[model samples]
Target: MKVGIADTTFARYDMASDAIDELKKRVSVDIARYTVPGIKDLPVASKKLIEEEDVDIVMAFGMPGPEDIDKRCADQASNGIINAQLMTNTHIVEVFVHEDEAEEKNLPEVAEGRARSHARNVIKLIKSPKKLIKDAGKGKREGYPDLGSIRR
Candidate 1:
């Protein structure tokens, strides 16, 4: 199996590094990495990876700043990613960490943990999607602790 990693240079942390490490530990797959200048470029980068690299899935990582403008950009970028998914009929796991999600001292840990957890999800998505379905309503999160299902 092959995996595509699209990361942005503007990110405060190198999330792709953690993701690659986790992927290496969990599965044996070819990794195709594409680096872009900012989060908004991720959609094209991810699509290119899917088309040119022939990866089965993509992991798009970005860190938006703690600003309203940044949030808007993130939202637009996310929509573009969704459009890319529909255009290609492929799954692009969007992993975005906002700078304000945690205190400055804890930001790295939060970002890394999020990347690693999402990496695991990526593996499950390809190898065993049933595993994910089994956890429906479980409120699984990437950086933070999972929130158990409220359903009875």
Candidate 2:
């Protein structure tokens, strides 16, 4: 199967590369890559990758700037991604890293860890759907820390 990697140029770093490298160790799939200006561009890029490149799946990576507006843009992009997935009948695994994930305690590592983790999930989705079946309704909180019961 072919996989697509769509990342943003606005990112402080290229976490998508880390994910691709991690995926290479387990699967031998063709890769289609596209770099956009920011998170907002990911949805279109992902759709093109699926529709044009004909990829089986897509991995989306982006780092929102340290601002509330950036987070809002990310949220809008996420909604678009879902629409794109439904429209294309494909899966686009999103891996986003916020600039303020952790004050100054090495956010790059956090981004890398999350990107890689989601990459593994992509592999699992193709290789073992049963494993992810139980995760239904968990929402897309993969990279972020589990806050657990935000509102009781």
Q: CA lDDT, every prediction?
A: 0.95, 0.87
TM-score of each candidate structure, all chains considered together: 0.98, 0.87
What TM-score quantifies how close candidate 1 is to the native fold? 0.98
Candidate 1, poorest ten consecutive residues by summed lDDT: 143-152
Q: Write the per-residue lDDT of candidate 2 for residues 40-78, one digit (tens) a residue.
A: 999999999999999989999988988899989999999
* Total residue pair clashes for candidate 2: 0
TM-score of 2: 0.87
Please report, as a residue range, the 10-residue window in candidate 2 with the lowest summed lDDT: 143-152
Clashing residue pairs for model 2 = none
- For candidate 1, write residues 59-127 as lDDT tens digits: 999999999999999999999999999999999999999999899999999999999999999999999
